[model samples]
Each structure stands twice: as C-alpha cells, then as structure tokens.
Target chain A: MTVKVEKIEGGIPHNTIMVAGLIASVVLVYLTYANVLTGTQYFAFFGGLATVAALVWGSHTIKHLCSYGIGTGVPSAGMMAFGSGVIAMLFATKYGIAAPIVAVILAAVVGAILGYVANNVLNMKIPVMIVSLVEMAVIGALVLMGYAAMMSGSFELSALTTGSVSILGLSLPSYQASFLGGALIATAFMLGGIAIQHPFNACLGPSWTQDRMLYLAAECGFLSMIAAAIMSMPLISMGAALVSLFVAVIGWYYTYAKYIELSKRDAFSWLDSKPIPEVEGQ
Target chain B: MESIVFGIGITALAGALATVAGAAENTESDIGSQGDPNSQVQLAPQMGYLHRIFNKAIAGEPPAWGLWIALGAGIAWAFMAMQVNPILAIVLGAALATFVQGVYATTAYLGRTASLAKFGQPVFVDVLKSMTTVTMAHAFVAIFATVTVCHLMNAALGHPFPLPLLGLVWGIALGAAGSATGNPFYGKERQYQNQKYGAGVPIAASGNIVRYAEAGERNSLDNGWFSARLGGPASGVCFGLIVFLELWRTVLFEHIAAGWGAIIIGIIIILVFMVIDRYIEVWARKNYGPYGKPAEEASS
Candidate 1:
C-alpha cells in the first residue's frame, strides 16, 4: 500500500491579497507626504505601514516565482528586485510630489526588462516570470521609499541627501546625519531586502502555506520598522521616532502571535520539548 | 544642456564597462563553481563521484560582489580624496580586492574539500593553486570595470549618491544579472551535460553530475570554457543593457515636465519588451516542443 501526502491549503487568493496590499501601501505612503505638508512628522509612521504592505505583496510574488523550481534562485531574485528598484527609487526622489508615482513606473520598467531577459535571452522558460518580476520590482521600490520616508520624514531628494543635527536646542545642517551622505541608504537596502525575502525563505517547503508566510513577512516588516524607528531618532523628532517604535511593537506582536497560531493549526503534531537535563558531575 | 550631453556620454561609457564586468564576473563564478551551482558540486562528493571541482562559495554572488566592490570603491575613494590619480587609485583598489578574492577562493576550496575527505574527495593543491589565480584575474577585470562605472556615475554624471553606495548597488546588480542569466548554462548544461539537452535535471538525478570531459574526467575549468562561449556574454548584454537604458532614459528625458518624460518613456519601453517577451515565449514553446516529452506523448 502507498500513502500519499496532500498539501494543506486555505487562504485568500494570492491576487486579492496582492491587490489589497498594493492599494493599501500606495495610499498609506502618500499620507507621509500629507504629513510633510503640515510641517510635522507625526504621521511619518505611515511609512512603516506602507512597508509592511509592500513586503506582504513582495513575499507572495517570491512564493510564486520560486514555485517554478529556480533552484537556489530565491534570494537572488529578491536581491535583484531591490538592486534595480533602488536605482529607480533614487532617481524618482528628485521629483517632489510625484516621487512615489515615478518610482513605481520606473521600477515596473526595470523589472519588466529583467523578466524579458530572464525569459527570452536566458531562456528560463518560467511562464509567470515576467509578471512576477514586475511585481517584485515595484514592491521593492515601495519598501525602499517607505523606509526612506519613515526615517527622513519625507522622500524628497533634498530631504534624503541633506543632514540635520540639533545643536543647543537648534536644528543645524550636518552631512554626517543625512541619509545618503551617511550611507544609511545602504542599511535601508539590506533591511528591506531581508524583510521581503526572509519570510518565504524561512517558510518554503512542501507544506508551506501563504498565510503563515505573509504573517511572518509582516512580522519581519515591523521588526525592520522598529530598527528604522531607532535610526530615525537621529534624523527626525524624538516624539515621532518613539511613536513609530510604539506602533511597530504593537504590529510585531499581533503578527507574531498569528504566525504561531497558524503554525500550530498546520502542524500535524507539536511537542513542547524541554531542554536536556544536565548530568551530575562524574 | 552640456551636463546632459556629458551624462549621456558617461552612460555609454559605463554601459561598455559594465558589459566587460558582467562577462568577467560570470566567467569567474562559473570557473569556480560558485553560487547556487556549488551545492551540486558539494553534493557530488557526498554521492561518491568527486573529481577536481573548485568550490568557492563563501556567499551568494550579490553579497560577495557587494563586499568586494564596496571595499574597492572605499579604498579608491580615499585615495582620490588625497589627490591621487583616479586611474591609479582604481587599479590599486581593484588589485587589493582581487587579492582578497583569491584568499577566499583558496580557503573555501581547501576547507570544503577537506570536509569531504571522508567521502573520498581529495584536496587537490594543484587545482587550488592554478584555479585561484585564474579566478583572481577574472575578478580583477570585473572589479576594475565596476569601480570605473561607479566613478563615472558619481564624479562625471554628478549622481548624488556617494561612490561606495553606487558601487554597492551596481555591484549587486551585476552579481544578480550573472547569477540569474548565466548560472544555468554552467549548472545545467555544463555540469549535467549527460542529460538530454533542454530537459532539466530531474529530482531522481540530483547530485549526479557528469564526471568526465570530452578528453578526460570533467572539472570546473572545463565548465568555464563552455560558459564563456554563451553564458558569460549573455549575462554581459543583460547587465549592460539594464545600465544603459536606465541612464539613457534619465539623460534624455529626466528634465522634461519635472521628470515625467522619463516615466512615460519607461512605460513605453516596458510595453515593447512585453510584446517581445510574449513572442519569444511562444516561439520557444513551438520550436522546443514542450520540455521533457514529445508532442504525441505529451498530448496523450
């Protein structure tokens, strides 16, 4: 007799999840611009929400692409998405109010071309490769811009490139504190790339499910947000940074609990193994 | 206007340099059996079919290239600040980076092979001595070209990003392009050549690499020769075109309507590629006649 194992599956369709995440992120990220217009950084934490949404979309796309059996290409795909997306994001920041929109367009173009090359030129023969790449690229750009807005309180080119420090209760320009000038953009790139890729990498297997992966993705996003919030302390107001941190902690807790609950539900059995007992000295 | 023209010129130069870098980078990785394919090489030993293959996968291509380019650019940036000749500084920095890469190749090859000694895989010192230099030479060419492209973007084009950051971004891009577009030719075609062409490695055949070459037992050096003909150049064009088109659009259209022109052109470019990609996919499917089986068999 042969025994067959079936993968357990139940969740919202991936397309619906992707579209919802995309729309939510784009709207939430724009709120940062509105907050900037009000000359206060209070709503800057919207950027963290936007990042979580984008990572959710991105992790799903990664799951879709890696299903094609591109052996060990999972992390490479994530890095490629961010590598190209970053160029688009940096370029788009020059446009004041339209930076986010321009970034999406630019990233889509870059991602589409990469997909074309991978399919036609390299002949990878994966059917959804092109569309998956385009989505990954846009998600990557959104994540970067979101984190940039979170830390710098704006995504404008001047805001990203200029530094500021408080000297004796007065704000003053200082190159060392700037995002680009201080090489903080590199940190953002690594943080965003890991957050987008790690969930799928950690959860992928024969029995992997979408809900668990996405929940972990959100948890990773919030963890990254906490880091960005800490980094933002040097760049934005202390009150704004603390608020971002508070929100990130709450998001992280909710997602972490959900992920654990899902793991228990999907698991065939669970053993709460304790630490090995120490032997007495001989 | 002059700056835009200069930017266009710089973009062209950077594209040319990137092409060389991409080619060299892919060839070097293929020769060393680095990145994802290194797993197969490692598995070959465990499965009891181990010849001489250089396994120098310290990390994936992106992070490895990121560290190398960042180091090169950092050193070059410092020297340029001290008023050294830019060309000399770049050469010195690339040489130093190449030395570090060679050291990594040596240790990785020795350590991984030594660990597999229980599986009867011998640590070939001669293979290590010879291949390390070849990898280093290719690494130097790739590093030098990438660093020059970063310098052109930062110093000549006046891109607001610093040299090291530009290096990191472009370095990761180059590595990604090579890993995505080139590795299959080495991993599937070169290493698993005994399998029928276009039929991917099946699960049952994992770790079963072709151990013999046309003349004698196969090795990583043989893989290099095969990948150089197609994989290396293909990766070059992929990366080179990405850099060229990205800079080209910005140079030609960035100023119009507050950079909206570039956005519009970018959309047009994507639509064109979408059409081309669809055509290619259909053509490949018709010509190749489905992956693993004949048309009649597949239909049945």
Candidate 2:
C-alpha cells in the first residue's frame, strides 16, 4: 500500500561509487588508447574496442544503480566536456598520434577533473547557466590550444580545414550513393540513440538521457577525421561515402535533434545544493 | 544599470505579489483553520507563481539564458557539422535546440511537488485556470522582448541575415517546437515508466507547479494517456521534422532570410490558438499537471 521513496541519508555509498566510476573510467581509457592499429583496419579494430568499452565499462552498467545511469545532466555534462575534447582532437590531429595518444589522455584528464569538480566539489546543482560557462571555457581553450598546435607545425591551421582538403581513400559510383548513405546513417544514429535510451529508462528509474549524448559523442569521436574522404566526389565511392555520409548524418541528428529534450532521457538531473547562477560577466 | 533595474523591478513585483497573496491566503486560512492542516503559513500559491516568474525573468534565468545558451550552443554545435559538411549545421542546431528544450521542460515539470499546493484555501486548480492570463503576459513579453533583443544583438554583431529578425524567428520556431516537445506520454501505469511501487505520479503533470506541490499530499498524478508520452523519444521525431523543414529552407535553399520565416509561422499558430481557446489555449491543456498529481490525491 505504501512504498516510500527514501533519500539515502545523502546517499554516501552511491556518490562514492559514482566518483570511483569516474576515476576508473578515466584510467581504463589509457588501455583503449594503448593499442591503435593505423588505417582502415584500425577503424574496425580499435573503434570496435571503444564501442565495447562503452558497452561494458562505460555508464551502461551503472544504469542499474543510477536512475539515470549514463543518461543524466551530470553525466551528460561530463560527456560534453570529454566529447568536446575528442572532437577537438579529431580536428587537430592527423588521426595518427592524436587518436592514439593525445585525445584519450586529454579526454580522461579534463573530463574526470570537470566531472569530479562539478559533481563532487561545486555540486553542479545549478541551472543551465553553468553549461554555457563550461562550453565557453572548453571551446575557447580548444581553439586557442588547437591554434597553437597548428601554428607550431608548419602547416596553416586554417588552411588545413578549408574545403580544399583532398578526398582520399575509396571512390563512389555516383552522388546518389553519398546522399543515400548520409540519410541512412543519420537515421541510425538518431534512432539508435533513442532506442538505447528507451530500454535503459525502462530499467533505470531515471530517463538515462546521457546515453543519447554519449552515443552521439562516440559516433563523432571517430567520424570527424575521415569525413572528407567519405564526402568528396570522384574519389568518394558509394561504400566509403556511405560510411562518411551516414556518420555525418547521424552526428547531425544527435547533436541537433536528439540532443534536445525529444527523448526526455536526461530528465532526472543531479539536484545539487546550490544552483548555478547566471554568469554576470565574461 | 538597466539589467539591475529590471532585476530589482521583477524581484520587487514578485515579492509584493507574494506578500499580498500570502497575506490574503493567511487571512482566509485563519478563518477556515478548523478543517485544514495547512495553516502553517509557510507556503503560498502566489509564491509558486513568483518563484516561476523570477526564474523566467532573471537575465540569465532558464527562460532568458536558455535563449543565449541555445543560440550560442546552436552555433557552436554547428561546428560539429563543419566536420560532417556545411549543410549538417542547420540540421544539427535545430535538433539540438529541440532536445535541450524538451529535457529542461520535462525536467522542470517532473520535479514540482503537489503537497505544497494543498496548503491553502481557494483551491490550487483555480489558480491554475489563470495560467492562461499569466502565460499570455509572459509570452508577449518574451516575444517582443526576444525579438527586440535579438535584433539589437544582430546589429551589435553586424546584422547577419536580417539580424534581430532571426531572433524572432528563432523564438517562434522554438516556441512551436516547444509546444510539441512539451507534449509526451506520462502516467503511473504506463509500461515504459513501469510503475511498480503503486505508480508514483506520472511525470508530465510537473508543468503545473501549483497542482504539483498541493497534490503531493494525496493519491494523485493519474493524468491518463497524455502523461505517459511526455518523456518519450517520439518528441525527438517531431523535432527532426521541424529541423528538416527549417534546414531545407535556410541552408539548402541558400535563403538565409528563410530562417526568420519560422517565427512568422509560429506567431500565426499562436494567434490562431489564442483566438479559439481560453487559458487552455496557451499550454497543451493536458488536463493534468506534471508533479505526481497534487500530494493529497491517491498515490497513483
């Protein structure tokens, strides 16, 4: 007749587990980075590992303990920081040393620190204003650091990303293939994120909204580097282009559409003590 | 000076309203003290409205900050598209904005408490009926205020693509989608929610903070079919459609002006609905509130 929803005396054990998970996750990431086979073979090889890692080691299992599991505001914000770093690496590195070394290290370090501080120290219970502050800091840091990284190297950083980058790898038969691939992948990522979040919320009491954001981040993690090869014509083939197009399309859907409240997976957020106030100054 | 002045004005108004309403409720509660246990005089119906209004009016409050955050996040998020292709930016921004809006709204709704609502006379639902009046006030202020500020921001930034007009369009476009995002399944017995422990109130009724707080005292929150879908990803698909149309018009057609067009469409929709409906017109009239049906109702 009466089932009381009890708050766990400030839930000490649960908070410890969460903090431990963050530390463990950041550390284990070193292993994911340790073995990176270069080339198309590497895509299937290490990319497979990353996905598996996300499945086994990432927040999926934690879903049992947490109402939100991987889908939550605190987790989402953590992923945003980590994901931003990964995306930045995707842009800055040659997919050689960057993916293997720099990206993983930076993601683990920056993400864990931000996560620990926000959840544990600052008690990230504030409104969305902190998100803006976090974004500005992360992006601003990335841009400045990335600019320096680009400058130290002889290549012009601006020129590197300009539309002129040559399309290498495989070639597609027709433009239709590229279009078709993009559309299909976009749907998969969008639907996949939704699908994952759906079953998760059923299991975890919370909506698990972070799952959608994380999946989007993971998808973008690898896709950013080889996108041009997938998009360019003459060199772009239906298969590779499909790969590129789908990857791009999915990223587009998740970042824009699915990332919004459409799924409600991120519904139950970390209710911290002090709400983050609106930023009054730069 | 302007920001501080506005903040003080809003804070004072909210305070004044709370004082008058709380006093009025107190006087009435004292007269009727024999029956109701809610005479502690801690919570006030007007205070609920005030809490909400302050959150809305604060310069960096969710209502106000959401715009800048949404806009900035939208534009920066577009960079992810740069990795994919130029066209993906528009698609990404719309979808992202939609999701953010949905999550915040749903999150806001679910956290509301119904037990707080019942602590008074002049039933909370009566206050809820007046939502139309307040929502209209806020919406007009939001629209003109948003459009004007957007225009000014555009001028400040050198007027890219009709400048402030884009803000109006962005607002309307968001508002319309806001309507859709706000719509979803919720209820205690729903399979997705798996209401095992006697179904704690459906998460959708959170939109009505008054009912949410007051109803917390009883077995309530059985808002039926509409509440169940409130948190589902179906809203995502709806967001996709909006993003697609806007993207095709603004990015693909190369008619950047079309970006503002959605605002016109949003305005027309709101106007039509306003003309036909009463207080129920502005909100989805879900016939339910979000916070587990005021606390006084049955657990379900």
Candidate 3:
C-alpha cells in the first residue's frame, strides 16, 4: 500500500516556474497592497498564497536533500531558508523597484556562504548543504517578500508597521499602533514559513510525493493568509476575514484529499480499523 | 473602537493558533534515522569543537557554554547598545545570536548519528535533515515567537524595552534548553529507533531523550498525540511567557543599575529560567515518559 514517489529533482524548467511565480506574485501582490492594482486588496491574499506555492520549490529541494538527511531535521532546512530570507527582505525593502532583483541576489549569495561554511568550515561534510542552503535562502527571501507584499501591500518597513495606525478613530498612541503591527507581522513571518516547512516534514517517507506535498504547501499558505487576514483586519476591508477563510477552506479541501488518499495508499492493513490480536510467542 | 478590540482578539487568536500549528508541524522534524529505506548515504565528517561542546550539554552534562555564551553576548550587546544605538543593536544581536545557537545545537545533535555510518548510514543527508527540522523549530517557536511577543508588548503596551537584549538572553536560554531537552529526546528515540530500524546510537533510559517519535510502530506518525501536538508548543509558550515577563522586568527597572542592569537581569533570567525549565522537564518526563526499553536492550 506504500505509494512510491521517484526522487524528485527539479531542473531548470521547474526552477524557472518557481522563481517566476515568486517574482510575479511579489510584484503583483505589492501592487495590490499598495492599491495600484485594479482589483481589491484581497487579491494580495491570493498573492501571498502564490508566493508560498512558489516556495514549494524550496520545500521540494528540502525533500530531495533531506532524503539524504540533515542531522538537525527537515525544519532546520526551512529555518535556514527563511533565516536568510528575512535579512534579504530587509535589504530589498529599503531599496525601491530593485527589491526583487536585489533580494534574489542577496539570497543566493547568503545561501551560498552559509552552505560553504557548513560544509568547509563547520566540517559537517554535508555535500548538498551548499546547494540546498542556496535554494533555501532564495526561497526564504521569496516567502518573506511575498508575504510582506501580500500583507502590507508593499515591501516598505512602514507598510509592515503601520497596521495599527489604520484602526479607525482610535487614535491609539503611536507605540501601541506600531507594536501591534510588529507583533502581527511577526506572527505571519513565523507561521508562513511553517506552511512551507510542514509538508515535507509531515508527509515524508518512501510514499511521499511532490504533488501531494505541494498541495499541503498550498494549504499551509492559506493558513498563513488567515493569520495575515486576522492581523491586517484593522487595515483592510471587512472582507479580509471571509476571503481568507474561503481560500483556506478551499485549499484545505485539496490538501486533505491528497492526504487521505496518500494515507490510505500507505496504510498498513493490520493498523486499519480494528487491531488484530497478537499471536502467542513463537 | 469595537473593531480595534475585535482586531486584538482576532490577532491573539490567530497568533495562538498559528503557534500551535507551527509547533505541531515542527514536532515531526525533531527526529531523523539512518536506516530508512528512502535515505541516501553521504560524506561522514568528524565533529568539531563547538559540536563537542554542544554534545556535552545535550548529553545532560552541565552546559558549560551557557554562561560563557551569555556573558560574551551580553558584553557584545552592551557595548553595541551603549556605543552605538540600543534598539537596532538588540534586534540584530538577538537575530544573529539566535542563528548561531541554532547552528550550534544542530551540529551536536547531528553528530550523534556517527555510529550509524558503519551500518551504512547517509551521514551527510541525515544530519542536514535533522538540522533542518530542529533549527527551524528553534527559529520559529523560540526565536521568532519570543521576539514578536516582546515587540507587541513593547510597542502596543507602551513599555521602555530594549528589544535585542531580551532577544539575546532568551535566545541563549532557549538554545541551551533546546540542547538540553534535545539530548534526552534523541536518546530515547534512538533506543526505540535502533531496535525498530536496526542498531545505531545508544541512548540512556533515565528519561534521557523525551521520546519525540510517537509510540507504537517504529516511526509511525500516529499513536503519541501529546508529544506532537501539546508538548512542544506548550513548552514553547511557557518559555516565551517567561522570556517576556523577565525581559519586561529588566526594561521596566533598568534605572536601578545604570546600563549594566540588563547584564544582571540577563543572568538572573538564565538561572531562574533554567530552574523553571528543569521542573517543566521533570513534569514532562513524569507525565509523558518514554515508551521504549533501554538502548542496549532494545537494540539487542
């Protein structure tokens, strides 16, 4: 009953799709958040989802490399990716128009440096540590920038911190608004990364498949969007919650379907339904 | 007014929910094995000094590194805060130190799998996967969650806070705790794991490793709900709350010791947190104890 997925190696085309999705989602989401886009700001919600979907490439890299095993665990790979991501995002946000390009470059360089250190200086001798880390770094940047774009409507620091200011008529003290915003974004940042890391870690085994994992990745992304919606509800229109819930529910459908299928496909018969009585000692 | 309150409620609810979900997913990443049929072998490298230091801590020896790491980090932070700017320095310092601790803990944790190489282990890949899981868990649950909460309190609650200083203290504490907790969890799991999959590393049964993997079938994701869903996040939230309260005190009472107050506060925090964390550990052990036999017996 084990569903066997081949070793998934994403080549140039696959990588291109992920990168393209990341850029497109970030740019479009940013525009939507900034009110430059034609549609409602809620489109940025989907953009956030897309950004996470793109990061699925990074997750796939984790799956492929983790099959080799990272001594710390699968989540370490995701953390490393996102760790570099937040830094690159900080730098990119400070620069306008050049944000995506700058972030990508910084992510690659940072990831490479981290990988080199782990392999050479750290002497851990993880062969793919360099490439996996490099990919993870880029994915991390995309996730951060993409999430930022979706939530704040732009990559600017102010956009991220200004959530509390949008609360109508409260005239809440400056500190209160700023603190509220920071907390909210921090939540999104932490949780969004989870969406990417969770699929590979949870579903891994011989029976794991990239397609199924990607579905879970989308579900995770939707879950993150829900967090974003809750955080940004003060800033955005009332529909943010409903829309976010709608997307999450829909995404969960696909993710859960694949999960059930995979589980059934991989289940051991003895563990199904009732447990069989144990035989006497041989 | 009504909406703001509603927003606050939703944010807290969402943050808590996300924290739970993230922590649960993180639980899966805590363990890796060498004998998996799907695994591939890679280069086996020797452990370094830092890894050895971390190993001692993980193996339940008094963590010699905590005091030194904290003192060193505190000095660096104080210098930066006094000489340069306070806020940015704290943030960067915390962020950087957390990342460093993440690497330190992960390296030692991975080193334990060296024994599996003789039995055809994919040392490199396994280590990386293991590192990936635990590091991310530390980063998300311990580091980010703590920082976010601190910022929320500082800004929203209108406290005079030094963000990074709190982050640094909490980071070191969490790192130490993660290392300390990790050793036993790894020990117990390896015992059950070696028996289930084949011989590998030895683990003490004195509740050494906290049995991260669920009970029942080897590596089965089902069976143990407590470890996966509750244990990690519950501990994480508790740790975060402790960090918040302690750091809040330091910032609130910084006038007491000139600039050096944070250092004193930091040390007190480490000591107090360690004590509380130990009790928490004992409670966890007493309640959700390991399900496996001794490593020797199980593997045999």
Candidate 4:
C-alpha cells in the first residue's frame, strides 16, 4: 500500500509569507541604522528580529526548492546561499547607508548565476531553482547583515571593523573584535543555515504539514536569535543584549509550544512511554 | 597595467589550483560514498542488503570543507605571521587538516557500521585500513590546493579579507560545486547502474542499490576508479570556471562604472548558461522521448 503524503491545502501561500518577511526584515533592520544615528544601541534587538524574518522567508524557499527531490541538496543549497551572500554582504558594507539595498542586489545577481549554473551546467533541472536561490541568497545576506548590525550596532564597514564612536554615553566594540575577529561570522553562518534548513528537514515526510514546519522555522529562528543575543553581549550594552535574549527566549517558548501542539494534532497516536521491559529470555 | 598583469596571473593560477582541488574532492567523496547518495548506502544495511560501502558523511560537503580549509588556512596564517616560509606553512597546515579528515572518516565509518551491527553487518577492518589512507591522500591534495588559492587571493590579489575567511568562502564554493556536479553521476549512474540510462531512479527502488561487482561483490573503492574519470573532471571544470570567471570579472571590470561592469558581466554569464541549458534540455528530451514505458513493461 502506498502512503499518500498529507499536505494541508489553503493556508497562507508561501509567496505571501516571503513578501511579508522581505518587507518586515528590510524595515526592521533599518531600525539598527536608526539606533546608530541616535547614538545608542538600545534598539539593536530589532536586528535580531530582522534575522528571524529573513530566516522565515529562507525556510520557505528551502522547502520549495527541496521539494524537487534533489537529495542532499538541502544543506548544499543553504551553504551556497551563505557562500554567495557573504561575498555580496562584505562588498555592500562599504557603501554606508546604501549597504542594505546594495547587498540585496548583489546577492540576487550572485544567486542567479549560481542557480543558472546548477540548472544548466550541472543539470539539476528544478523549475524554481533560480528564483528560490535568489530568494535564499537575499535572505542569507539579510541574516548575516542583521546579526552583524545587532552585534556591532552598525552595518558600515568602518563601524564594523572599528568600534562605534561615543554617542550618548554608549559605545559598541568593533565587529572585527566581536564578530569576525573571533570568527563569529562562521557561527552566524552555521546558526542561520541550520535554522533555515532544520525546519523542513526535520518535519519532512508524508505526515508533514506546512504550518507545523513554519512554526518550527520560527522557533529555530528565535533559538538562533538567542545565540545572537548572547554573542552580542561583549559588543553591545548588557541591558540591550539581555532584553534581546529575553525576547528571543519568550518567542522560542511560544513557538516551541505551538509546534508541539501542532505535532500532537497531526500524529496518529500520542503516548507517554515508560522504561523498556526486560527480554523474556533474560 | 602591471597590476592588471599580476591580477591575470593570480587568476589563472588560482583557477588551475581550484580545478585540481575540485577534481580531488569529487573523487574523494565518491570513494567514500558521501553526500546525498550516502542515504542509499546507509539504507541498504537496514533493508537487509548489507554492503561494504565506506560511509564517512559526518556533515555535508560545504560545512566539512569549510571546517577543513578554514582550520588549515588559520594555521597557515598563524605560521606566516610568525615568519614561517609561506609554502612550508601551507603544507604543514594542509597536512594537519588532512589528519583531521582521516579521523573524521574513521570514526564515521566505525560508528555507522557499529550501529548496523544488529543488521549483522560486520566491520571490515581491511576496508577501513585501506580506504582511510586513500581518502586522506585525496583530501590532502584538495586541501593543499585550496589553501594555496586562498593565499594567492590574500597575498597576491590584494583581497581585503584575511586568509581563513577566504578559505572558508572558496572552500564552500568548491564543496558546493563538487556536491552539485559530481554526486549525481555517482548516485544515478555509478551506484544504480542496473537501471536504464536517462531513466531516473523510481521511488520503489529507493533503498535497493546495485550491490554486486562483476566478479564477486562491490565496495566503495571501486566507485573511485569509475567516478575519477568523468565525475571528477566535470566537477573540476565547474569549480574552475566559477573561480576563473569570478576573479576575471573582479580583475578586469570591477573598476568600470563603479563595479556595474562586473555585475553586468555576471548577468551575461548567467544568460549564456541559460541558453546552453535550454539547448541541453531540448536535446535530451528529443533523444530520450519522455522515459518510454513503465519498468515492468520495459523489463517484460
């Protein structure tokens, strides 16, 4: 007997979520810039929220692309997104206020090229490969830049490499010292990647539903945000980092509970088991 | 003008090194039955078709390569900072990284096989003893070449990023290239050779891989010999072109119109590949004619 995969139809479409995520991320990340101009890092947690928004979009794209049955491409696609995104993000950071837009454009172009090569040269032949890749790449750039902004309280290359100047009796450490110097970008890369990929990967199968997967994605995003907040402790003010951490923890708890509820609703049977029994021969 | 010439030289050398690294990486992965195809290898024992395929997939290619190359380049960078000879430093770093790769490979194999003990799959110590060295050798070559390319990008091309960062980036690209290009050949053609060409693996035949050799029984080492010829070279070209074109655009066109020229060139390259892909797709469809008949009908 064949097992038919159950997909709950008529939820919010992926495209809509993607668009909402894009808008929310862009606007939220700009809050960091605003905080920068205001001479305070108090609003830096907005950058963590921005990362969560980007990961939500990224998780959808990963699901769309992996549905094509490119076995093992899930992690590769995630890594490739960040690989190209890092190049574009680093280049864009040089442009100051224009950096975010520049990063989006550059990442889109790089992702398109990589996607084209995957389709044409390598012959993966998934229909949505190019567009999904472009989205993932942009999302990757946003996550990295957002987390960096949160940690450093600015996305400017100079501000990132060198600590922010004194403003309103508040100063942040250089990103080079706090982020790249300790290779925290690598941590960010892995954190963002696992968050984006794990939702679909863990929930994949005939029993998987879109809502459950997405909630898990949000939960994973909050978990990564918690890590980001902890990592920012040395760079940003302790109060700001603590607040970010607190918010992320709250978000994680809510999402995790929702995900568990969804899982229980979907499962054929739910049980609490005791310890294993001894063998008859024993 | 002189700097352009120097840039061109660096691009060429880096591209060449990337090509060799890509080839070695593909061969190494195919030999170990790593990547997406390892799913089949892992499934086989559980499905009661225990085989001797070496399973060494601790992580996906990108993260694995990122760790290896980053560690190598980090050590090399440290040594160079301490006034060590660049070449010697690179070699030492790569050698140490290769050792780490071997450790990962051994543990992965042992651990995976140990878990399958309930399936009556015995640990072939000989397979472990031989395949580990082979994978280590190829990994060394790949790591060495990749570290050199990152060094050139840092020392020669005046790239602002440090050595370890460059290593991490390009190492990911290399692994992505190999995983995308070569894994298909190994997964579809090499492992599932019993299936007809151009007919994709059906869902029904998921865990049932071709386990026997022409003589007695198949092992992972045999896969290396076959994949090295075609899959390895294909992966090499893919990665080599990526490195060459990316560096070429940066070197020649990055200054034109404040870097829009490089962006335009990148778009043009994508357009060219799209055209080629269309041609290939049309050609394959015309030749294969839509998968023909059902498996049962074809066999009958």
> Per-residue lDDT for B59 in model 2?
12
C-alpha RMSD of each candidate structure in angstroms: 14.0, 19.1, 14.1, 11.9
Minimum summed lDDT over a 10-residue window in model 1 chain B is located at: B107-116
Which 10-residue window of candidate 3 chain A scores lowest in summed lDDT?
A: A268-277
lDDT values for all models? 0.78, 0.30, 0.47, 0.77
**lDDT order of candidates, top first:** 1, 4, 3, 2
Q: Which stretches of candidate 3 lie over 4 Å from their true place?
A: A1-34, A124-127, A164-181, A270-273, A276-282, B1-253, B268-300
Candidate 3's docking class is: incorrect
Question: What tens digits encode model 1's per-residue C-alpha lDDT throughout B1-300?
Answer: 888878888999999999999999999999999878887887876665656677876457877777567656655654453346899989877886676567556545644554454555655656777788889999999999999998988778777887767878888898899999899989878888787787788877788887777776666778888899999999999889888988899889999999899999999988998999899999989888656544375553
Q: Give the alpha carbon lDDT tens digit for every residue of A1-282 in model 4.
A: 112223336777878988999899988888888776788888888888998889888877887777666546666677777878888888999999888889999999999998899888988777788998899889999999988888767887775675333335565444334456645576567667656775665555444567877777787788767666765665667688888889888998798778766665554333222111122332
Please give the C-alpha DockQ score of model 1.
Answer: 0.03
DockQ, all models: 0.03, 0.01, 0.02, 0.03
Arrange candidates by TM-score, descending.
Answer: 4, 3, 1, 2
TM-score: the better of candidates 1 and 3: 3
lDDT of 4 at B174: 86
Give the CAPRI rating of model 2.
incorrect
